[model samples]
Target chain A: MRETGRPLLAWVGLAARLVTGIVWIVAGGLKITQPDASINAVRAYQLLPSSVAEVVGIALPATELVVGLALVLGVFTRGAAVMSAVLFAAFIVGISSVWARGIEIDCGCFGGGGTKAGAASAYPWEIARDTALLAASLLVASLRRTRLSLDSLLFATRPAERAATEGAMT
Target chain B: MSSNSKASARAQKAAEMRAAQNKREARRRILTIAGVLGVMVLIVGGSIGVSLLNKEDVKAAGAGSSEYGVTIGESDAPHSVVIYEDFLCPYCGQLERATRKDLARLAADGKVFVEYRPFDLLSSIADYPIRATNAFAVVLEKSGPDVAKKFHDLLYENQPSEQDPGSMTDDDLVKLAVEAGATEGDVRADIEGLAQQAWVDKATQEAADSGVKSTPTILLDGKVFQDGRTIQDMADNLMAELE
Candidate 1:
């Protein structure tokens, strides 16, 4: 039971890592080439000051890509997952705030965020998707032992430690 | 008994050494993660700095003007209707087709201050929006708003689909401007030369700054138009409001 559960959890963590990582990569890729659109999207939210919004617009795409790379390669699984969770949480907050304030805005998750018509109706779905991503990020953060990952290769347990751990497990 | 005691002591020492090594490894991993996070922060900061430094300066003809918009009615009209539009947007085209005559009539009747804000929101997707906006800018600057309004309508009437926006070239824009009553000399040259490109860029940024997310965003009395989806519904609502 223990062996089966451990492998399954690791696989689940791996899946979570890939899912979140790929999404971040796609989102960042879509916005990275269109700086004006990114800035416009950030501006449409009207949450941040203009200067701060510009900075976020410039930095967010690169940050997403880097975090996604880290997660996909499983180089820093826990750290990447934490970053992912933070971004998702921020999106949820932004969407909720817009909904509360009765502002019509596209969440701009993948790209093209602006004051789209009928945008108010999409807030709930955006929040739900982000919430689900947040949950996946949390799962990846807690379950640090993922299979087929750079972490395993880079930080494998020493022989003596492995033997000790295996013996204890048995 | 003595040998057994020594073996157990050696085993305990080995366990202690292993624990210490594991602790060191854990600390090193944490430190490594911290270093990586620090690098990420630096990257973000550097990117922000670079973007700010490399930002384009807006130098449009209408950059610092108070009344840069194309006005269709008296300044002190009782009702104010502002329409933000992009030439490349299909929905904007539809909206214009639906309400162009009514808006003009209302403006002409001295009942409303109708303003048309033409910007190039889709410059990233296609070049036509900026080109068309630049042509309109020249018309507005040289030929005046009446001619520019005609040009605006002409562009919409000849609007190309998003997939084939390249069909409309500089020549086509100049021809349309001429057809709209602008002369075929300097005005045509200005349209071809993209004389007002910077102005279009500035206006686009201004639109984004003002939270004009999508094209055809209509504002009635300085508020987002929330009357209804259909054009007729919106017109009825605006008329009711004005009444």
Candidate 2:
């Protein structure tokens, strides 16, 4: 019944959805092309065993791409947003751990990752970026009925339907 | 009045029916979302499972032998220094230039055992790394580690700029092998022919399996040596460790 700022909130959700969606697509696309580089990037973190890292390296890009597609299309928007949030949170933890462990590596978020000459300085910025994306994904997850979304088209009751239902109720 | 009451009852029935339809639609939407998420999870998990299953355990394949890499110095040395290097990696070159003599001296003095794992990590970008690694393997196989060590230094010395990496040819590597004291006659044929390419491939995979993802990954006594970032820092760290 409180509908004063509903449109504004929907617009915010739309923006959040698009931002995280496009980022995931781009990041996943870049990594998928160079899987070996991706694997090396995961290995650079030095957190997981080689076997686990290899599997993650091979599978992560596809997961990112699917999540991105779902969010961008606004189909299963909540589910995709939740997945995005989880991934960004994991990335944040990984970056923080590497920083704490004194390992120097590129975050490898958008592709090109390995041991670099002066990569430690970039960890803070990478964490900040992931944290921001995580926040945006959380917003999208909470506001599942964003404007101009497939969820709205497929799931939300249309104005005509709402009117008919309300008329019957009254 | 009777007609009015009948119409109101009909209207109430229609509303209840509409509400029921709306509920069903919401349930269907939730089910659809759940189904899509389930499919996504299956895809991610399935691919990861397949890849892990396919990934061979290279460590188990080699049986803890020097087939994985080349070791320099006495086994009885007080310390062990392991280095992973790619011939084409510029930073590896820099690190080698800085620490080559100190590491060798430490090894020769029986203070440290140095192991060099040359792998073709940059093969994704260029085949030159693989070729160079193959050449190193050939030299090591034919002439042994002393000449191979010289060949290693020479490769770094002739390392092309990353911009023009392909400029260095197999002939160039063969020439370096000869200069480094490998037997001139058959060594040239072997280096150019990539006679030890299989060994190079095996060693590279073994290095990767061993978690040497980046070049110049130095492990001191089986632990990552991360005391510094710069070549100077690495050089200083190695020297300090000797004392």
Tell me how each candidate scores on DockQ against the true complex.
Answer: 0.12, 0.14
Q: Write the per-residue lDDT of candidate 1 for residues B197-239, one digit (tens) a residue.
A: 8898788887776766666767777776635434455566666
Lowest summed lDDT across 10 adjacent residues in model 1 chain B is found at: B57-66
lDDT of 1 at B243: 50
Model 1 clash count equals: 1
Deviation in angstroms for A21 in model 2? 0.8
Report the lDDT tens digits of candidate 1 across residue range A120-165. Answer: 8888988998899999999999885787676665455566555554
lDDT of 2: 0.78
Expressed as tens digits, the lDDT of each residue in A1-170 for candidate 2 is 22225888988888888889999889887777666678778877777765676768888987898788788888888888999999999999999998997767778899878765457888888999899999999998888478667665455456575565456557
Instruction: Judge candidate 2 at residue A23 and give its lDDT.
Output: 95
* lDDT against true structure, model 1: 0.78
